[model samples]
Target: MDIDGRKLKILEAIIRDYIETGDPVGSRTISKKYDLGVSSATIRNEMADLEELGLIVQPHTSAGRIPSDKGYRLYVDGMMQRTHIEPEIEEIILKMIKDRVNRIDTLVEETAKLIAMLTNCATIASTPSITQVRIKHLQLVPIDEHSVACVIVTDTNSVKNHIIPTPKAIDFNICNALTHILNESIKGSTLSQISLDKIRVSIEEKMKEYGTIAGSVLEAIDKTLHQEDMPDIYIRGANNILDFEEFNNKEKARELFKVLEEKPYLLQVLDHTPPNTITIRIGEENILTPMKDCSVVTTSYSIGEHTIGNIGIIGPTRMDYGQVVSVLEYVSHHITNMLREMNDS
Candidate 1:
């Protein structure tokens, strides 16, 4: 059966109310709270139609109705129009993200935190793969006589620091010379291009005396490049998940937490989203069993040409679709722009 505009409005109101108050919505509440210009009896009839349509359900026969997965799906797919984020809130999000754009990992981490704060939902972020990222500059700073900090700057404006053991005699002057040699040899080359043999040959030819230091640097670079297994996954505001009534059951909440602790599960959740678009997976629609009761809103962010990483928010199925969609879309767009600027500068 086709739902009329009036019925749609009533369903939207119920979803919104349930999202805010975490309770079943009744016709009286809709009549009092929403200016639908309809009487409670009329709303009751419409809600009955909606419940029959399987859009909303009552936990108990005596209780009012709450949005079912079907209802939330309708809201997300058809009813949830793109809404503008308030200027003040947008600015705050952009400012927080801009401050961290100098480094890709930092930017991803901060984006997760900002999304969690703004959405009051659990947020997850994954760092971009550097395998294809070219080295912009390589600097070796002597930490002491026995250690050196290998600072690798990528063309995507990501900065990574790896500390390596070095000869006790190796000082700043020697490190400076090695830095020049390393930069000249590997600058503008992708991480894949800076192979161990290539680095070993280059370093040994130029500074054989500091071969141990060169080996250390090469090890750091290798570790950095082949870091596909550990893609800096970040989680923020996980505690917020408990704030929702859907997760109020201790066993259910513990199960969700246990699944979240598995990095592979989190990776799959974030990776499923395509770049430059938003995806909403409602309860039972989620591939992960533990997340079956939850809704995930995800959007991918890029640094340049590379579809670097994704940020996602996890909340109850009753999540405010319009608000979460707008926040994720805006933040993802801002991150792309800021990162592009970082590269250009």
Candidate 2:
């Protein structure tokens, strides 16, 4: 059957009511609460039409109806226009970024926490993939006869340290010279852009005897970047999911908690979402089975062509779709701008 304007309005009303009350909405509730200008009989007929269209469903025990996943998909797609975040919320987020966030890791963590606090939903933010960052400074400090400590600072100001064993008779002063040479060659270049073999050959030509030592230290830097290249994911408000009635079941809640606590699974889930778009996944559409009853709104931020980070919020399928989406869209855009400004500065 074709859905007329009346049926569409009724479907929208059902979705709104269920989102507000978390209960099945009866025709009487719709007739009394919404000024649809239709009588109870007309509203009941239209509701039946909605059920026939699979937009709404009736529980076995209740005469009232609730929105199905398809119903919510429709409501968010068209019925609701994009709404701006409130001024108070925008101000809070802006102030937080201006004052508290400096490093990329700290930015992701703070953003996740703020989202969790503002939306009261479980939130996640991923740090920029290490492969996309450029080396800002590479320092080699002597650590006795056998080892030297290699410190790599990225353009984002993230620091990583590694230790490499060297020849027992190696020149301790070799640290200072190699540090200058490595910086000249690799600084301002991304890890992926660095050619370790070419660098080794080139360094050996410049400082023949200590060339191998430079090569050894260079390998340590490479290993450090590759070993920990995975984006560090920050998650917050995991327990917030428990407050929702949908997660009241012990087994269901436990499964979601496990996914949140496991960084690998969360990383995979967020990584698969397309970048630079606001995506909404509802019910069975979720890749995680434990999330079948929940919905996720996600978006990503980037620096130039490289995607720097991703953020998402997880809540019950009956979430306030308009509000969640507005906050997510605004926050992710703000983060993208902030990162570019930081990178340039």
Candidate 3:
């Protein structure tokens, strides 16, 4: 049977009480705390309907009911109100982004710390694939007559340097001219996006006399950008998992800690979380066995339209979805905005 208004109200009450108190919610508690205008017996009957529909469950033989995973999905989709981050908190995040613009790894770490602090849950932040990072700046400096240092900076502010050996002896003046040509051609292109042959053809056409020198530099840039290392993951507040009652058990805690440390599971979760969207994975929905009883809230961070990485919070199934979701949503968005500006500037 379709849930009536009264049943929906009762289900909402149960879920809210369970999340706040981390205890099974009895019908009497709902009748007393919520103005459902229903008596204890009536509330109990409605709760039974919810449980029978697999919306809630009783942990013990005679205890009050708690929302099932299905119940949480329903509430999150239909009942949870959208929320906004505080203006002061937004300001703080902006300052952090500005301070750490040149060091994206440090920024990711700091962001993970702030998220864990706000949500009081374990937080993991990862870096974007280097191959997808557009070149923000590239510089060539003559080390001597035979060698030049090629420094490439990506949109994420990660810097990679390669030493290039010129076919012919090159001086400072020659390096400056080539640097200008290279920068203009590759200002916003990633290493993977750059075609060595195409760049060589274009550069040689410009510096018709320096064909060999252009090839050497182009090859070095291609090699540098082709190395797509796994994303760097920074985890904070992992210990916070123990704070939840269900995860407090030593066996369960150890299992989860192992998963976090190994990170195979977290990466898998990141693969499923689409960019620019917040995903909530509840119990049993989590891919990792250790995370079966946990709920994860995740969102991706992007520069321009390219998603570089993701950040997430891990907690018990009875987590405060609204609280964690609001923080994740705003932080991810602000990070995207700031990084986009950083890339452009």
Scored by TM-score, the top model is 2
lDDT of 3 by residue, 1-345 (tens): 378999999999998899899989999899899998979999888888899999999999765998998999888888886567788987887788779867888899999998998888999988876776888788888888788898888779887788877778888788888888888888888656666787788878988989987887787767656664577888999988888898868998999898898766778867788879999999988878899899998999998778889999999988889989988888888788888787666
Alpha-carbon runs more than 4 Å astray in model 3: 83-87, 142-148, 163-174, 203-217
TM-score of each: 0.81, 0.94, 0.88
Please give, for residues 5-88, the per-residue lDDT of candidate 1 as tens digits: 999999999998998898889999999999999899999999999999999999987659999999998888888777678989
Per residue, candidate 2 scores C-alpha lDDT tens digits across 1-345 of: 357888899998999899888889999999999999999999999888889888889976788999999998888888976667788989999887766456777878998999998888999888877787788898888877898888888776777778878865455466777888788889888888888888888779888987767677777777777888788999998888888888999999998888888988888768866878888998988988888999888888887667767898999988888888888888888877777787788
Better of 2 and 3 by TM-score: 2
Report, for every candidate in turn, its global Cα lDDT versus the true structure: 0.85, 0.84, 0.85
Candidate 2: C-alpha lDDT: 0.84
For model 1, the superposed segments whose C-alpha errors exceed 4 Å read 37-39, 140-150, 162-186, 192-220
Worst 10 residues of 2 by lDDT: 167-176
